[model samples]
Target: MTTTPALLPPDIRVFERGWLSSNNVLCLGEQATVIDTGHVKHASETAHRVGAALRGQPLADIAHTHLHSDHCGGTAALQAAHPDARVWVPEPSLPHVQAWDEDRLTFGDTAQRCARFNAQHALVPGQSVRLGARDWQIHAAPGHDALAVLLFEPEHGLLISGDALWEHGVGVIFPQIDGSDDFDTFNDTLALIERLDPRVVIPGHGTPFGRADGGIEAAMARSRARIEQFKAQPAQHALYAAKVLIKYQMLDVEAMPHAEFQRWLDGTRTLHQLHQLHRPDLDWPAWLALVLAPLFGKGVLRRDETLVLDGA
Candidate 1:
């Protein structure tokens, strides 16, 4: 069933966004806070929307479920807009963020962009934080991003599931793609969500969905099936990831010249690693072509005589 804003607590507002950015969760209280700002390209819009939603409530804090570029890219803009707002990031990410290590943070590796921002606090798993009038329990949610966390409010059975859980599927297993044994960790995260038994889930993307009456079960089943396939044939997962990255880049701009697209594909270190690990025989250009053919055939992307465009 569809979940509407009215279904959420009166003080909470969710701004569902497109693929380029993650959904923004605004928790209003004596200390107004916003969780998971969108990508940098949409930073201004994100700031404007958040400002309007606040209705003049001084933004006391900004929080992140994880520091993926899409999830935290607008942070710098938000901080500028609300100078008094304190930023809170995951405890494990605190060091990298403080040092501004884009490599360790995965921004450079993924060829994604996030303007530098600072954090004044960290969200530790198993701890609790108050947002609006409720206390949220923080739980470690790795696999999608090794440092990710999910927030749960027992009083309302509401879960703020970042990329760990979505309506159709989970986020790409970056740890696995990056040469870590994290498929099991991803499953463990799904199991943890099952034990929580939330009544509703505010996922990082798409509309929030009810977990009661088979919604959560169905989503889990689909996610498990997808992960199992990846486990059985990891090369397939690598190919899938390549397409996702390409589409994500396309979403950031109206169009790109073929040469620029090739350069981007060349520079994305993660893609190169995936290529080396999964299809070394084909070479980079051939591998890229193989990955792009399906995206073009499905109309997920289109190419003119000189430029590539986002098809949908």
Candidate 2:
């Protein structure tokens, strides 16, 4: 049976289903280039899809906006499939890629998050790449990650924003972990992007959007609001951590036991320490109290003398 070919958009084709693992795009031309590959779990499939999209044309280059696992995980697989293809990455990420530093890549405690990929080329600001005969400009987009870069096609007024600008806010500003949340820097980057006047924006997550609609503005506003909320209650940091883990695991809350869930919370470094320090205000002995409150209200967990997964 023949598999359906990856979706294409005139000269620019987008594989839009991978939001959590940002969508992939293939630009068909004299020099075929693919913008960002999905997660490692989907790497093989992505390579196959890209190969099919090539349609006998050689894949000259593979470029990544950043080194995030979701953004570059499939690089190795793609290269293995097309041995002639050269991997292109941001200049800052070059050293890490060369040294093969898995730790520096921030693939969580598990290396499973990202696969090893070699960078044969570097994309610096002002550098131009010819995709299907038109030149696309590369710009440094730092804030989410200091090494991140964004691609802009001035002729077509198209921007492959990557994680710098998502449909519903930007990617997590990871620099905050080191106490360097320069909101000003992020704002500057956004302003710089606005000046480009991109007619169409292909974000790292969500659908491709037009600048006319209030989508970009709404996302920026939500990002600012979240930053303010993050500053207000530090406990929200722990909550944010929980939310990320939950989304990653996609756990069926109803199948979780209260005690087991509490144990999971206790195992987390931030959550455990936060519970201990704020014992007076939060009451640690009743640790399961706050933990279950939200889930219980959401009908994800039920409490009947003892906590149990709601549906289970």
Candidate 3:
């Protein structure tokens, strides 16, 4: 975990992982707790880190902000390591997690992976939970993911913001790809954050940002502007979403044969849904070309006759 003493409370330790995985927040307390394990690819490392941090103490709970693959993929691994650690997920997603339904969880549709795990409890909004001697109020954060929740520690003005609020912007509005107009909900979540007025924010994927870095208000303003841009040019947002999916795949594989990557792209339902909804005039091949154009142009990725390589 990186040490950013000025931005974080003494009890919280943040693992600032990059794009492929969500940051892991380790809360030190009498009852040890780990919030948001990273991607499956980093499961072993995550468990090792948590175990080292525990210094032989048993992990009491493993909680998630949401059930997105990157955010919760390491849950199964952690559960295996600490059999008694209770796994908790958002209330709305408890049933799906209990059933281990990849389809219902959107893992299958997004072409992402999350090993099955059991949830022993739900993180419902309007509730409070204790971690590391601090009481955190759980609030529903519904823009990036409808079922997502944020943990706010009022005493220190600390917020554990998942993908719902990031330094740059929020995560891709996933429901949009599935034919849902959730932009308004996303804005509402932003408003909720404003009301919370946190002193420091621990985001899912980046370094913690707070009053020193243009403050939370500045971040909110940037995100609001981005939302308006997407609203005005819905097609642009679709194209951005397409690029994100492709880039995520690239990050997962690092490099893949062009044919294999194409097959995977063809199999991902979200990409097809985005294309059909936004650019139906073009045939599949032409639409794909359009999606790949900027990705290749800006060196976010590179591909030759035989392979696709991650350049970003």
Residue-level error in angstroms, candidate 1, position 287:
0.8
Task: Please provide, for model 1 over 80-196, each residue's C-alpha lDDT reduced to its tens digit, 9 standing for 90 to 100.
Answer: 999989998999899999999999999999888899999989899989988666789999999898889999999889899999989886678899887766688999999999999
Tell me which of candidates 2 and 3 scores higher on lDDT: 3
lDDT order of candidates, best first?
A: 1, 3, 2
Q: After superposition, how far is residue 164 of candidate 3 from its true place, in Å?
A: 1.1
Residue-by-residue lDDT tens digits, candidate 2, 1-312: 121223224778778744446588788788788889987767888888888888878888889988887789788999898888888899877888988887677654322267787887888887887755468899998877777889998876888888888767545555544345554566667877888878777877677776567666676677667666655654565455444444333222334455776565555443454454334366665764665467567754455656554432
lDDT of model 2 at residue 257?
Answer: 59
Q: lDDT value for candidate 2?
A: 0.69
Clashing pairs in 3: none
Per-residue accuracy of model 3 over 99-211 as CA lDDT, tens digit each? 98898898989998888899979898999988666888999998788789999999888999999888886578987767665578889988999899899988898888896
